[model samples]
Target: MQDDALFPLLSALAAVYAAEPREEAGRTARHLLEAGPSHLGAAHANDAILAEMAAALAASDHPAVQAILAGAHLLPWGDNPVAAQAAAAGDIYVVCTLMGPDGPIPSDDFRMGLFWQRPGTYYALHSHDADETYVIVAGDAEWTAGDDTRLRGPGEAIHHPSLMPHAFRAGPQGLLALWRWSGDVNTHSYRMLPDPRAVAAA
Candidate 1:
């Protein structure tokens, strides 16, 4: 939470990364990143630099940007999970995991790697601090706002600027998407957040 304490975590990780063989560390980082920042889900973004990254993501075209622009742009990583999932899913899988979105912290901005959905599922209603953009990479998706609906396919996108009410459901064939948190997601808010029925009914 505090700048003074942040370095210790980084230092611990750095120490581990330095001591491990390069190949092993590389493998480890890949695993961590793939896990979608859920571990640091609410922690990492607390940093000033991370906060800026969120904003950069908010204002840029992802998977196709050159550098940080308007202080809020980000390009997709080549070995990014979407590429990997698309490769394995034949253009129809949920295509893999949710984006490793940067987390909470006012002074910071963030980006979401990519968040897709499996066929026939509702992502539930959610919202965050940074404005965001979702680009459909493959297949189709349906985003909902109250009673309104927007359907999209590859190359199509939806933008939700901070606090706007929204929700998504993948198409019958699933969805592949890229996302952006157009500003600091220092305070992500999910509307009607997920809550499964605790009772199992027959």
Candidate 2:
């Protein structure tokens, strides 16, 4: 029953990503959709912020957002491995990998996923070998890449090249975004850089 519900939601999500004008993001999502799901294990993770995420999604009119809201409970939600290792208060967000090497849909060199962060939470600077793009599905955030920062809301897309440092601070309503990874997709190269706040406090 769950599998029946999940695939359509994933297809809706792929459509959402494919609609992006950015070449890399659109191509990666379409490729994964064509490859299809492997129907892997039913893994789940616990996080306090998921409720807030769902509430935010409920306010969105986008079809993809509605699709995720309908099937969010069926997704294999989990803590980000790098966030688990580096976060000060343990896991601050939840992720659902719909496609990747380890996700239900298998892809060797790319990944597609959803991410939700708690309200007003700050994800410090981090970098990894894979190139990444995040498409905001609901809520808002202040995103920083190197010396620049911008307030991004729903339907906005942010791209980060391999190893380019980036960070996010979720807005009052928190954040819910779809993200994709390409190039070197291995998480082993992920690193948490020095928090700028800590550096400033020193």
The list of candidate 1 runs beyond 4 A from truth reads 1-107, 191-202
Candidate 2 structure quality by residue, lDDT tens digits, 1-202: 6656666777887788778877766777676667554463575755355578787887776668867776777767773545545656334567777777875677787787889877877887889998898989898888997778989889887889899999888898888998889899888888888885635422
Quote the lDDT for 88 in model 1.
Answer: 31
Specify the highest-TM-score model's number.
Answer: 2
lDDT of 2 at 202: 26
Worst 10 residues of 2 by lDDT: 81-90
Candidate 1 local lDDT, residue 136: 58
**Candidate 2, residue 1: CA error in Å?**
1.7
Whole-model Cα lDDT per candidate? 0.42, 0.76
lDDT of 2 at 167: 85
TM-score for candidate 2? 0.87
The residue-by-residue lDDT of candidate 1 on 34-131, one tens digit each, is 44322332221123332433343344343322222221112122322224312333322222222334222111234444444556556555555666
